[model samples]
Target chain A: MQSLIPLMRSISGAVVLVLALSGNSVAEAPLGLGRAVEQTEIDAWDIDVRPDGKGLPAGQGTVAHGEQVYAQYCLSCHGEAGKGGINDQLVGRIPFDAFPFGSDPGKTKTVGNYWPYATTLFDYIRRAMPYSSPGVLSNEEVYSVTAYLLYLNRIVSQDTIIDADTLPTVRMPARDRFVIDDRTRTESFLRQ
Target chain B: MKNSVSRRIVVQRLVGLGGAAAAVPLIGAETKQSSAADHSMPEATARYLGSYPSELGGRSPHVELKRRPLADYASVTPLQDLSGTITPSDLHFERHHARIPDIDDSQHELLIHGMVERPLKFSVADLKRFPSVTRICFIECSGNLFTSATEHTTPQMLCGLTSQSEWTGVPLRTLFTEAGVKPKASWFLAEGGDAALMTRSIPLEKAMDDAFVAYAQNGEPVRPEQGFPCRLLLPGWEGNTNIKWLRRLELSDQPFMTREETSKYTDPLKNGTARQFSVVMDARSVITAPTYPARLERGWHEIQGLAWSGRGRIVRVDVSTNGGRRWHEATLQGPVLPKAHTRFTFPWKWDGRGAELMSRAVDETGYRQPTRKQLIKARGHGSVPYHLNPILAWIVQRDGQVLYRAEQWL
Candidate 1:
């Protein structure tokens, strides 16, 4: 029983050592510390160009290149003019309140009216586009299609060069409208 | 039990069971007719044979009941179609934020760091080496029934995003011991390795309670879609809390407050306040078979449904014949598990009277499932679109057709 003291102390000492080592490793690791995002890494993943122009990639594509890209990749479903016939409408003056299908009775929410960020357009298209084959387009192809879509939405001119520097500055009308959801407290009370 | 049955028979005679007995005969005829008519829809053809005509292996037949594919998610096991509580692993509902990552078991590692005595990286084999524990529990997505708020939604659109499976893994305490979690750590972040890199902050108390790092579902290695190699299993909580493709667990004193928790899973109420970290699923039940797109024959039919609660076991499930006018207790199947879907049945005979059929779940906490009107009154009718599990109503037509009765929150 007398030897139990050293054994107990030794066990605790080992535990303390393990704890200290783990603490040091965790503090040293930069797993998800929200560091100052690098420009190169930001450019790679920052495909989302919000309405006010943020996180847009570098490089530019002309309307002609965009037109060719659209026909090759998008025209199959989005229609030749990209006005949307069989699929959801991508072009035309969007009246946010009007319903095109009338079958749903729900208001027709289009990209021009509801999409709060221009960055989302690039991001979404880069990630999942063409419906038939998503994530297949190259970065340049994504840029061209994005330009063409924006031109179709009537938000930008046909010759407007969209790159990383100018993409984040493109002001979207819905930018200020979409408020971050504040529904936490009410949901709790209702559940309670 | 036999004595009680005899007493019930005697009581039935003393109460002049003539009227009630007559009602039973009428309902019986209605059931037989409906069964004869509902054979029109291709019930047998609806069985999903796993994969999209592409066999990546690891598929089973007993697990293919209520399966529907969406953008990045899928529906659950049709509890109404199932006989018992055990959900075959493959048919388990999937709710993934990003594409399933193909993780090589050899390279996969679980890094446990932060406020721990021994921050350690455990390989897949290492996790299996720990004192393993197997448990039966249900994991459900918080947004499981986002579309089920109205009558227009099908069961697939309703609360079909939850599935129960026998999870085999190491108890979290084992990993905690290996990593040596510090006393000061109150919260920990579970991060995934998908493109979205989903992360959620979990309380240390939950980690100490029933938390586990599961590597196998049912009797085999975890399915790729259900987070192959390894994932965190928070039994009874919403699905998102159980981080899939689990790669990192960082113990901390504060919440990480990831975008998925703040922006996506949070529920927006009528008061314009969006609720965050609302992980527990309330008690709910839905009749799957005789539901939308299924026409009935109007005869003796078994009213089958599933009832579950995140808090605990579903103590009772009440079925209403004439809409919400009157209610009768349904018979629950044996081995009713807490936090698992419990199958219930009520043998009913319908008389071809155009009526509305619905079921309400009552949990051990005595919280009864609320109707659309009641839910709207509490949450307010607006454009909020997540965690909506209002009582679902199905309209029975005289022509033996059953359609989902869509309701609006006005």
Candidate 2:
């Protein structure tokens, strides 16, 4: 009890000293300590749903609902019917040619033909979708939209359900096309 | 009397907060330094600024040069902390697949052999002997927009690959005349000696225009991260085109269709096709200061930002007070170099008005900076994200709070 009193007194004195120093500036503290992050505060910004379906939430939606969601949230930028707007086309068919260069004419490659994993679509959309409000969609909504985009790209049937289980299994046409970068001979020749 | 008591409590809290904030650097130092040995002046590096630590060769002394997510995969430039258009070469962000290799300039030679009338080899010295031209230009990476995401990506992603320099080098034309490039050769392969063995094929016409075999940046020899000894400087083109540590130039009838050109750099679009060979960076502008995570005071402040275009020079950069509703031309910092980042500034009288602000770049080519919407409209929403040079806006509240504005790209 005797030691406790001295410790408390010292802590209070330290706090008072700090209070005196910080009082000189107005543009110092923001949101106040009360509004400052609480120890138990959940970090909403750390949301990153991986392509392997790590952070996906559980919910259910149909292609019909996805069409509506796509129109409401995604269509303005991505375009209606997934044809594409000012942003990238989320849905498409047909594999890229041997000479798929810039997004020039006669070199159209899309999700159905190029992306190796269907889960990549779900992960990318959930994390960075609608362009304006990313990470704002529900899991079921994300699944439904993924299903709808797959259907539009001719990768999935219209009635197919897309969930964590089935997303990895959904085969993409250009899955095996990508290879790791190789610069061995190129570098050796340059050294000479 | 009760109000005064509450006010005193608030003042007490404020004082406590200020002291805590001030002590953050000290606490950070204790946490940031891993060892006691690190505390002493590295003994050898006292002549240099900051701790180059030998672990990371290129680092700035200023605390502001530090980027978030300090990792090997990529590093962001401290755009908000920088002042002039010319980014201190040391502060420039570096993203390489492998470690930088040291090349002996004495032994270094550029071989121009394939598809030419006369296969020629020019040593670093021989290449410099030709008529050399020095010009300031900006080199930006194709994937510079990764940081412009809604969740405030770091400056590394925003415009890390982009850098301005008064590169001194011999023009490709001068070299072409010596090598006697065949007319049938439409494209040329530029190969690098780095571990990634980076390679890219560029059109001969573009090469003949303004490309050069650069050997210097700013006033010094180029850094290893920048492809020292020799590097190709393709002004206004994607940074990848400016191959560092360049060694070979092989002329060909067609592009080698390297993996980088075919699979990596290409942008997939709505029509199920990809856009390739699109090298020129579109006009873009960003307010470096007062960006995310930076606070400001309410007063007369100078709005500063960087503007650039791949097609040509930045003629004017207009600032928007009420978002994009009202626009006024900002004064561009002098000696605006072509194909380089032109520093633009505007004096603003902030009455603590809660408003959204943005700047739009206008290039000499007369192509006005596009909004996210305009870019989407032209490129298609299905298009892959690359070369997205939209005007970035920052929302400011009366309390001097600034946040990246997630505007409508469409």
Candidate 3:
């Protein structure tokens, strides 16, 4: 049994070395099951936008054009000037320093007070908006409505022209209020 | 014993002499009268043959278990009606951002692109060709907090957004490896094909760990409500991260910060800071049997429930019958796999006195589940929105009625 223990230890050490060398790659030989995909094919489905404005499309929208777009497609659900209706209130800023939504159930979390990134507004509206009809808006219309909502939130002025380069530069009110998850496994209770 | 035997013999002699006539009054007037109208006798039932075989089978006609619909978007599993560990595929909880999409498996395709040596697209058939793996784990919603507790609330109504199943799938790491994932790729975006096009950013480390693209659940094809052709299954992570009806995987150096991850699912703390990507569900347990609405009789009973931890296996579950003043170690049912629901039981007797019943779970990580008061004290009333795993207590009245001890922090 003593001799067997050394042999087992050596085998386990070799296994660890193999794992370390492989890194994220699987150790097994590739099955080569899937077919290669082209970039254009990926582009059609790649609609996600990052905080640093990685995937924003080339389109410019003014707050004036955005008002018309919001009135036409977003007014019914989001209400007049995004003050809120049956859906979520897209415009509200109860002193960014307050951060009372966590405790107050009556407080509404709008795009202005809760969302951390201006790019998220574009990503969310472009992917999911109008509740009844999603992905129906043109990229130009999505940018316009995003700008319109931002204007209502008072983050951007009515004259601000929101395009690919300018949208990422727009700082959100709740940007600095967010933190990464710090909950650890060792803690028997949640960290305060 | 001899006196009872003599009594039984006298009764048998009387029954033998006058069959139905002598048994009528002794058996009770209600049963004697109802026997003539109802054909539910054991002898009569045994004489008849059962149902014939069919192409599709269903639950017994007498049994009616169903998922409770919260709204148009989600439905909760019937936890109290279940036994053992595996939640029946049909009864598994459903939480879809949009309506359930009906996609033909032949037309479904999974595209893996961005930050890879070779971007690949795999069909459902192609994925099936690869070596498959099976695991039994749970998917719990981060917002599965049941704060509206009442006397009528059952275990199903309290916390039923979690359910376990034997999931079979291709390990996501194999697919990532086949695609030759670049060393720079730290996170990946999982996109769904539903109308909402639900997307979530997942760490690549998790994808290489236990995450998989599940194609089957409980020995059958994944249901339409549960990401039909294939779905990403991140064991122990928040249910929303396991993107259903998976259509795309875009590897990136950083998180995409999608709407689901940002505007929703994030945990908000009392100190003005919200926690993003708080994915892992903490340890939680609930006493399913003898819970709310169960009237007890003065006799011996078994306290049965389930305990699970996302971090690891449930090492211990303590049952307290006296409002946590005393806790007895529960007997964990065998096959306690990691990241899975484990059944636990404790023998208990009712002394016809009012008592409070509670169960607390301790995971392999040595993290013990906290009571409602402890949870409130630590996180404050503001953190009541998500990831709530506080100990649930039930009050037994002197008259044998059970009710939930609902806590109010807000």
Candidate 4:
């Protein structure tokens, strides 16, 4: 059945072909084009971490260690304690009730005020960070940096140990503020 | 006095004989020497043989079309200087998070895995062997809107981040079919091979519909800036979602919620909610010619510009010579494919008085391009930094100078 799925998907009149094949009791056949990938190969490339922390590697990091990682890596571009310098600001928080980002140009969208998911920090820092160098951070380093940023944003305390289990549990302040796109191709320009 | 009278008589006779006789140098011997310097003697080109053709072709030295670099990471297309719909592959607008990575196509491979009936790894060669599809569509960044408008702003400087191309590649549906997607799989994560390893999550329905793995642009191998070996082409979606340098696809039940989708590309609204996954660019049009620094004369001129919509084809583009009081239907150039840039034109006779010119595009979906006021009213001030598709206005002054209206809201 799995082998026949490809042939059925490729052809427009697949229903008729499937009926004919079922009558003849013939075996299912695939196009036999690409080779099957191994789990190890998949694991090496699959670096995406989901909101539920599904793809997170088995590692733990503390805020104290995260501070060291921040000082070595993030201080120059992100400023002392993530106050901001040249690149994007990583710290600072707006009141959860106040969503002034839309009306005020002066409001800065920092990690604490804008990001909806804590898992995103781990995913982004792991895949692309340090601006000049990316994909160089170890899983521990990524977790530590993620902890440090979260700590600075006041989402987590210094005593907390961040791991795959605990990272997803940390609720971001802007989590509920995001809504799916609600645009439609109607004559009226008004957004609901 | 006698010599002057004789020359005048010769000039009169030459005038009587029309322009052909004037080139005969019948006045004096010095007339022959000065004739070499005459502006209308076919110049000096006919006197010498032209250069032979070379291995590669290039634009004429007289043509000075070029892409303007917006910053170190991005460069904008020269929209005002271009004609027709298809943007030249080299001059296409470029916006990369990191630098363009040099890739060897032979070594590149695409891996499709996770929740699939059969996880597969296919080389570039393998993907090309499958049936190929070609399409013409425009890829526009969500942040394509250039708000830093001034009187000196050109169309390129205003909104040049969008570009159209004829892409040729295998449809993603075919590859997914070969891999045999699981029934539970609803979304897939597209990851790039660049240093940034840029990633975006797309719904499976969109992948099955019009998405293709494009390897060629404008009948040539994709440019390095445009993801050289291969890239994903999601017709009508925002540019970033059509992940370039595509290397992997992981099927899943839910979206991975990548940084590009969550933190950066999302739009904030006045209602205290940020809109996520706002992919489609609404209908928009802009007058390119007789705009900004182009000194115009009071005679007949064709008002030309480009209009496009992500939802569908542009059905009508109305041009207004006066400030939105009266509008005339502009002629649309044929072969207007869906989600492609459509060229529109309207003839106008300028009376040397100050006038504002604007164009409004209506797509097949009946979505008319909104005015700046309408956009601001709906989205609120400073709320929408992305997906801004307001109709742009160009002011033509009494002194025959054209400038961008540069509204205060911008």
How close is every model to the real structure, measured as TM-score? 0.61, 0.61, 0.88, 0.88
Better of 2 and 3 by DockQ: 3
Going through the candidates in order, what fraction of the true interface contacts does each contain? 0.01, 0.04, 0.61, 0.63
What is the TM-score ranking, best to worst? 3, 4, 1, 2
Candidate 3 structure quality by residue, lDDT tens digits, A14-106: 999998897855536477788887778989999999999999999888889989989988889878999757777788888744777656756
Give the alpha carbon lDDT tens digit for every residue of A132-160 in model 1: 56667777787778778777777788888
Off by over 4 Å in 4: A1-30, A185-192, B1-46
lDDT of 3 at B377: 59
Model 1 chain B weakest lDDT span, ten residues long? B266-275
- Error (Å) of candidate 1 at residue A175 is 17
Q: What would the per-residue lDDT of candidate 2 be over residues B1-410, giving only the tens digit for each residue?
A: 66457645655655565865645455454444445525755445446564434754553454556544345555667777777878788766666544466999998777675567666667787776676789888888777875325636434445566667778998887776677788798988787766545677799998889999899988788888888898999998887888889877777776655545654576654444556677778788888766766556667878889999887888999998788899999999988878889899988877788877799998886777777775666556644457777788888878777777764332
Per-residue lDDT for B159-178 in model 1, tens only? 66777788899878678766
lDDT of 4 by residue, A1-192 (tens): 899988877785777678787785442335678888889999989999999999999989888988998888878999999985788888998865477776665688888998999999999998888778987778898899899899999999988889999999999989888887877742255322
Candidate 3 residues lying further than 4 Å off, grouped into runs, are: A1-27, A185-192, B1-46
Task: Give the lDDT of residue B284 in candidate 1.
Answer: 86
What would the per-residue lDDT of candidate 4 be over residues B226-319, giving only the tens digit for each residue?
A: 9989999999999999888999999999999889988899877777788888888888998888788898877999999999999899999999
